[model samples]
Target: MKKLYSILTTALFCMLFWIIFVLQDINLLKLDSQEVITGIIVSLIVAYFTHRSFIKEDPFWMLNFKRLGSLIAFIPIYAYELYKANWDVAKRALSPKLNINPGIVKIETEVESEYGLAMLANCITLTPGTITMDIVEEEGKNYMYIHWIDVAATEIKEASNTIKGAFEPWVRRIFK
Candidate 1:
């Protein structure tokens, strides 16, 4: 049952990828027979190799509507953050004075799952002015060491609040 679920999930994801990347067209009625055949063949091969990693635990968990909704919601929020960060970086770069106070700071995370922590770290790194250096687990807490272009806060809680912004909560919902 788990294997079947994994195969189905992988095939679905591959089909979505094919539509977005290979097809590059939204009109399904215009799709050629050859293209449909090719998509299925390629997706099946890819699914066979990648299914295990995606459905390591319960296969049905990922198919839940709540998690799917969270993922859909997260996309726009991430995009907005990415755009804002890029603009901020560009402004600082164009300015006469380099207003960067760079330093590595440790920020604690409440996310217990490895996937959740990884998502948080990646999100922080993607944001402008911050790069995640390392994630360390100490005394049952996860701490992310990040290099900040501007060190606004020295304390852990304040720094975490500043660096994480709205990402942590969404990630927690998605991965928890």
Candidate 2:
């Protein structure tokens, strides 16, 4: 039963990716039934290998499956935030103020999983005005060192919370 579930889940995820890729390319699926069939075949092959490779003893990947909805909701919002941040940074860079603090600060994050840490780090890097320097895992805690364009008062804490706020709840939905 578990194996069946895993196979189905993996197949479904692959199929989703295939569809997204096709739609992104905006290739006319109507005239090109071949593309659809090819995508399905590819998705199936990818799913089978992925399932075989990570099957059993590593349930966390599947556990993270529940976060799909969160991931969907986050992407658009984060994209917009990143776009806004880009403009802000561009303007700041061209301005006389140069508005950059260029400091590295330690931010404690509640997300402990490697996936969660990675997502948070990527989010920081994607957003304008910030760059993730390093992730420090000590005493069972995860801290991300980030360089910021504007290190406002309580900067580290605020940025930490911002990073967490972007994806933590959604990740919780997916993983737990």
Candidate 3:
């Protein structure tokens, strides 16, 4: 049963990719008989090869609609943050005095899973002003060492809120 579910999930994702990229149809229309047959064949083959790898310790956890919804919502928020970070970095670069309080600060994160922690680290690193320097686990709690161009607050809670407050909860939802 688990293998069947894994295969189905893999095939479904592959078919969706085929429809979007090859068919170029968001509505999934305008697909001819040959294209449909080809997509099904390709998806099935890919699923057969990849199904075992897809089913981890938790088979259906990642298939939750709520997590998908959170991911979709996070996209726009990330874009806005990216835009603001770019402007901030540009201003700092072009400034006359170049006032920058550069230091690495340790901030605690509620995210426990390695995947979730990695995602958070990548998101912070991708942003312009802050870079995730290291991730440490102490007493089963995860902490991120972040290199900030300007240190606004030295307190850990304040630093976490300032840097990852916007996306941390969303990431927890998506990866929990």
Candidate 4:
């Protein structure tokens, strides 16, 4: 079952790659026959090479269909929030108020995997006015040091939630 799932996932990604290439018109030969043959050869090579790593652990967990559904579901809402953040940043820059309280705060991350930690860091960096400075693991827990443009209350949990609410759940589904 695991091997089957892994092969399927690899095939899916290969199909995705072929689609991208076709859409981009990147095939060397204009002939459909040549393109199909090339795509098949590439997919087989990629699948064989990538198959082992794909199922060594939890490939199905990352391929969670429900999580993919949720991600699609959240796109519009997340886009709106991102737009709002961008406007807020622009307004703050233009306003005389200059409401920035830049500070570095240490926050705990519940995500146990390295992939999750990387996702958390990227999430913080993606959001306006926050950047993950460092991630330190101690006694099997990740502690991230983050720089925030506005730091209200010195609570670590609050800082942690900023990344969590924005992107953690989706990342958890994808990589945890």
Candidate 5:
């Protein structure tokens, strides 16, 4: 039963990604019979290889409406953060007296699953003026090393709040 759920869940997720990334023609999502056939076959194959890590505990977790809503809600929040980061970076770059303190800072995360951790790292990387260098596990806690253009706070609590911003919470809601 669990194995079937894993395969099914993985395959469904792969199919969703395929439609969003591969089959879509920009704003309009058009799909032919050939594309549908191809998507299913490829999704099944990918799911077969990746099912073990695709889901951790509950296979139906992603199907929850609230979690799915969080995933959808993250887009605008991410965009807002991107917009702010870009402007901040631009301002710092154009300033005559450079207000830059570039360094790597460690921040702890509550996201337990590996996929959630990856998602958080990727979100941090996508935003301007910050890049995730590494994620480490110490004493049952997840910590991420992020290279920020400006080092706001060195302490773990402050740094996590500063660098991660809105990324971690939404990711936790969606994935964990």
Candidate 6:
């Protein structure tokens, strides 16, 4: 059963990857037959090695509509944060004197699942002005050590709230 689920998951992932690759032009109506065939070949090769890693305890978890919806919703929020952070970083860069109060701050995350914690760390790293230095599990709680370009607050709760605004909630919905 596990092997069957892995195989199916690999096939689905391959198909999705092919679709995205072929639709890069934003024209789904026209697809080249040669490209489609090549995509399938490449996807199959990738799936062969990666399928096992993708298999979750719940084989049908990927089919959850609520999780998909959460992922979709997260895109816009992430984009907004990315844009805002980029602008802030650019402004700081262009200034004569660097106004950054650089420091490492520890922030507590309620995300218990490994996947959720990883996603949260990645989201923080992707945003400008912050990089996730490390994730430490202490006393059954996950704490992320983040290097912030400007350390606004040092307190754990305040730092966590400021750094993880909107991201934690969306990640919880998608991965928890």
Which candidate's lDDT is highest? Answer: 5
Candidate number with the higher lDDT (3 or 4): 3
The sequence of per-residue lDDT tens digits that candidate 2 reaches over residues 1-176 is: 67766666677778887777667768554537787788778877777778765454443364454466677777787778778788988999899876676666788887766766777788888787788889998898888888877776456677677545555666555444
- Candidate 6 per-residue lDDT over residues 86-144, each given as its tens digit: 99999999999999999999999999887889899999999999999999999989999
1 or 6, which is superior by lDDT?
Answer: 6
Give the Å shift of residue 56 in candidate 6: 2.8
lDDT of 2: 0.72
How much RMSD separates candidate 4 from the native structure?
3.5
- In the range 1-176, model 5's lDDT, one tens digit per residue, is 99888988999999988777863464424567786898899999999889987777888997799999999999999999999999999999999999999999999999998889999999999888999999999999999999999998999999999988898889989986
- What's the lDDT for residue 92 in model 4? 84
Task: Name the regions of candidate 2 deviating beyond 4 angstroms.
Answer: 1-4, 23-38, 52-69, 72-80, 153-159, 162-170
* Native-referenced Cα lDDT, model 6: 0.88
Each prediction's whole-model lDDT (CA) = 0.88, 0.72, 0.87, 0.74, 0.90, 0.88
Instruction: List the RMSD of every prediction in angstroms.
Output: 2.4, 4.3, 3.1, 3.5, 2.8, 2.7
Stretches off by above 4 angstroms in model 1 are 25-27
Q: Model 2 TM-score?
A: 0.67
Model 6 per-residue lDDT at 154: 100
Give the higher-TM-score candidate: 2 or 3: 3
Ranking by lDDT: 5, 6, 1, 3, 4, 2
lDDT of 3 at 171: 91
Model 3: ten consecutive residues of lowest lDDT: 22-31
As for lDDT, the candidate ahead, 2 or 5, is 5
Residue 7, model 2: lDDT of: 65
Instruction: Quote each prediction's TM-score.
Output: 0.84, 0.67, 0.77, 0.75, 0.84, 0.84
| Ranking 2 against 3 by lDDT, winner | 3
TM-score of 1: 0.84
lDDT, model 3 = 0.87
| The 10-residue segment with the lowest total lDDT in model 5 | 22-31
Note the residue pairs that clash in candidate 4: none
